[model samples]
Target: MRHPRLCAFLAWLYGNEATTGRILQQNQIIFPAIFWPAPENAPLDPDAVLGTFQSAPATSLPEVFELPGQTYLRNLQKISPGLWNGRTYCMKAFDLTEGRPTLTCSSGHFFDALVSCDLLEFELLSAFGEVMPEEEAFPEFCERLTLRGTLHALGNPLHHACGRSAAIGISTLIIFPAEGVYHVLLRSCGSRLAYLDKFFHTVPSLMMQPMLADERMEYSVRHNVYREYLEEVFGAVEGEMPYTPAQYHDIYADPAIQYLQNREAAGSARLLLSGVAMDLLKLRPEICTLLLIDDPDWWLTHRQRLRPVTMVDSRCGSAANLLERSPATPLYAIKLSPELELPTGLLCPERFTPPGAAALCLGLNQVRKLLLYI
Candidate 1:
């Protein structure tokens, strides 16, 4: 990597308690622990969990910092050529009031401004002095940038004032429940970007994007999650741009998509929103959720067919076909006991991406309550 010092500093920042404390001080969590559950302990309806998406004009990094930030990104991408600059749905504002979370977003790109925020943070800290320890320097960084106080005051971590595109990350934990046990699927990502070679929730943790010209379709988290599941888990090829209405119809008509929808409608499966939080390291917001399939029959019948595409392969055409791709990343099934407590050894907490670990914890908490009444 071009910025070895910055990279090494980040390595030290991961899982750092100082970072966690800073986030908590702003009333933001690094994990999926902020659910607005119903009175009966059931997850709120998916629609109720999210309020609405308000359209806004795109924002960019402050002009003063744009050049240096983009220069840093260019150097970093030299070693990670697989990085793609694609269109994104940038978060302008986020609000949760009365148990309903709403968002304001605008058009953005991967290279437009989101990825540079971390570099800017690092640069600001380095300006203080090279000799200071990061733990001590971080608070000063926040004070000078005022991002933490601004986020706390506005109640929006991705507030436009931060001068970041703030692209949203959508992460879901897929769980398959049998007789009395829950099987959680996990993915070990091999990409060089965020969360490199770390265990993330299977079913693909994706960024929010505008897949088509339809505003409603592009903004729907349900549609985004379902489409990602098909592409990553089943290796379904996404249609190219200038898409026709018929293309979308075919996408939703895929057997896997239909099955998931039917199971949810039949009350045998659920797609619940656990909560949303910012990754302390990058300041990126993640929408954490759970995809719980209560029926074991689905798993027993399709276990062999679950061919997950790796993060690297998904970005580039490294393999001729889905079957030619590398074997699926390690999958672990933590067999839950009658008490629903997760067993050790099968999974390691430190290996998980922060959002993934949080989703698993929150998902299991909700499932424990859900199964009690089932």
Candidate 2:
């Protein structure tokens, strides 16, 4: 399907077809919360918790985290009861029953469990949940989250504050050659990093990033970006880097972050949005914002996560003016075949098939937009 991200998103929302009794069989556990300390400089609140928890260092990427195990996953698996009605498939439907996030969305009002987090569960699906199979569960699930519709979703994407998934991410652009004003060096990352995404064949991505190790750390709006950068890119023995203070850009809190509701793609979007690109530039802005588009190899590697698909191939330069374009227009798509098809049009598809993931599905395009400077 053309809009593969949308397909994965819908499938993730649908979750596994488990019975209600089966899911609840798992022992209930407190949904863990690592309370971040409020700013020391800020005035104290009488209503706030008395004990102080250190705030995590701030970073440009979504903070990688984990939730309480099987209970959370089982709860997600059983969320799709009313096919098209009620709270439906939203992970937000789960509420904080003590620490264990419990399902409680009968009234259909937006749940408060999500918004009440320190770092926030940006997307809400189990990163470890079972993969979505090839068959289409809902008849027109893919068709609904169109590329234009996705762009519309992103531009106005709200209400997706928090949920039950770990934030995932990858690099989109990286500069190269060191000659031109901006040499775009899209590196095919080392195969060792393949687990971050599909590495069936080495991919020369425009960006580079290491997967989050899922370590324990305090969540903060500042301090952590460089710490993560130094850890991921430089592999520094000490916490410091060789770059002079002058060479670096100002480290600051992220003014905003985009959030979409679908659990799988929402976490996956972190991989796309919060890559080494952000922290790298903070090292000294030599590496510009990573240029990224959701193409086919991307679809193959990250088929499970649902999102918007742009469907930009050789014919269409951008989705900006595709208002009248047919939603089902055949994508002049390609795969890593014996004979590779060369790019010739404004947009072209040059992708290779990976080991596993969905065969075909509709997806969404987050943007024709490019280059997010840190």
lDDT of 1 by residue, 56-168 (tens): 56554555556666676886688777666766776666565554454566667777554454554545345434544365465454455443343335443433425676777
| Count of backbone collisions within predicted model 2 | 43
Off by over 4 Å in 1: 1-42, 118-161, 178-180, 191-197, 308-331, 345-350
Model 1 weakest lDDT span, ten residues long: 19-28
Q: How close is candidate 1 to the true structure, as a TM-score?
A: 0.73
TM-score of 2: 0.25
At residue 89, candidate 1 shows an lDDT of 70
lDDT of 2 by residue, 46-149 (tens): 11211122212222222222333223333433663321211211111222222221221111111211121211221221221233334453334334323213
lDDT of each: 0.57, 0.21
**Pairs clashing within candidate 1:** none
TM-score of each: 0.73, 0.25
